[model samples]
Target: MPRRTILIVEDERSLAEVLAYNLESEGHEVHVARDGRDGLSKARALLPDLIVLDLMLPVMDGLAVCRELRSDARTKGVRVLMLTAKGEEVDELVGFHMGADDYVTKPFKMKPLVARVRSLLRRPDAEEAEADKVSGAGLEVDRERHTATAGGEDLNLTPTEFRLLWTLMRQPGRPFSRHELMDASRGGDANALERTIDVHVRSLRQKLGDRAETVETVRGVGYRFNENAVAAD
Candidate 1:
């Protein structure tokens, strides 16, 4: 793995130092910012491979930073992993809504954090490359263009929804358990309630409308996208 650069936006000096040290040990170039303002500045200047952001920060706050990053075309594709002490569902949902690629509660294990960082950074770029060469069931996903269209209609999906659809579309006939879908779509939080995936899938199906049946429920197994179904919209 090449040396990936990561920006750490955290208020606690000690915790930031510890995280930076661990990430540096894994051969990543780490930069630390104590507040959201500085963090956002460094992010713009450095364009780090990833950002480890804390929800609570002085001045701008992590949510603002995420919004700014997502809004800016230059940084829109940069990966973000929210690191916060808040373990509530609302916080997690808010982070996801603000475009966080992953969320981690504080007092977490270093190994898992590093692994997730590696996994996320590895994903988007490679997937984008592969998606350009792929098409399916009259539904075309152009990752390079960051667009997906089914039956000649564009699917206006949020980033998470797009990731979820991409996961299923990529696998086609494979039955992905709700737990597996949740992990793949929303980052692996084993404690994350199963209903979250259902909610997103429901929303996705609504967007698909008459083509919704293309995504099939496999009794007790979970959900699968059947390319053969080719529902008429």
Candidate 2:
């Protein structure tokens, strides 16, 4: 795997050090920020391939930092992996809504955390291998440009949401299990909960607006793009 740059934005010195050490050992260029303000500053300056962000911080919180990153054209494409306290499902879901790619609960295992980072770093290459663009039912995804649109309006999707839509659009009418969607939406080392896929799907549908019907939930299975929706339109 090629070496990549990663930024760790955590207020806890010990935790940041541990993460930096592990990431560096994996041959990544690692940078550490002790607070959200500094983290956002460094992220904009460095434009790292991925950021390991803590949800709580002094100065600015992680949610605010994430929002800023997604809003700034210079930093919006940088991948974010949120770190939250254990069992904070609300924060995890909120992080996703704010455009996080993946997350690990606090007191996480080192090995799993390292795997998640590796997965995130490998995603771009995978996405680039796909066709440059795909469109149907007024929905369009441009892989080369990393952009999505619906009904002639641009859709601001997080990386995960974009990938999920891309996968479904590619195989319209084919039902995908949550496990399958989960894998397709994330990188090779993705370790997200199955329900996480549901959350992303909900958000994706909301963004689709009236065109939301194009993405059909498969009930007991998972989800599928409605091939007929495109034909009817």
Candidate 3:
């Protein structure tokens, strides 16, 4: 029951109202926006913990809003849960590539939707006793500072990306299944699709640059931090 703030950027008034009402009942503070433009504005202003965005909207579509959110430093770390009437696999991939943390197709059940929202809100707390720093493969991750650096350069990672890297690096040489990585990166509350992890990995690899090979795909399993690639410290 983390008391998190959420923004609902949905043009459908009835649907938005229903979501808001249910979310509020779960002890979350919720805000509503009628269109994509307004949604972006409020997102910057409020900097909510999570955003519930609809794909179809006036003024600005959700895709545009999502891209804007991810591009801006101020809102880049905020979690996004996309809602769409289209349930196609390609559409889901597009949303993930745009930095959405989760996705829900329209005509969804309230219970599962609320459950997904709860999952996004559950992040590791600041006081959690994780190793303050880890260094390997020319990458340095400091949990206390919530920062990562590659080859002495700072990495501007999204929250999900940071967690994914942290999880992998914590157990160098161990293969992590997509489902296991999903839970570690987003918390046990997360309802992330297996493919969603691939999107995050792609973004994370780009940031890793020359050290990208440190995160290796395990093929039939998932991914692992290649201990063999660790640079001599």
List candidate 1 stretches off by more than 4 Å: 126-233
Alpha-carbon TM-score of each model against the true structure = 0.54, 0.54, 0.54
* Residue-level lDDT tens digits of model 2 in 81-119: 999784577777898999999988888999999999998
Badly placed stretches (over 4 Å) of model 2 are 125-233
Off by over 4 Å in 3: 125-233
Model 1 lDDT tens row, 1-233: 66566889999999988998898888776777799998887676455679999999999889999999999975888899999999999999999999999999988998999899889878757434553434566776664466888788999987657756766776678787776665455521235576788889988888877777878899998998887777443
Clashing pairs in 2: none
Reference-based TM-score, model 1: 0.54
RMSD in angstroms between candidate 3 and the native structure over all alpha carbons: 15.0
Q: How far is candidate 2 from the true structure (C-alpha RMSD, Å)?
A: 15.8
Compared with the true structure, the alpha-carbon lDDT of candidate 2 equals 0.81
C-alpha lDDT of residue 127 in model 1 = 37
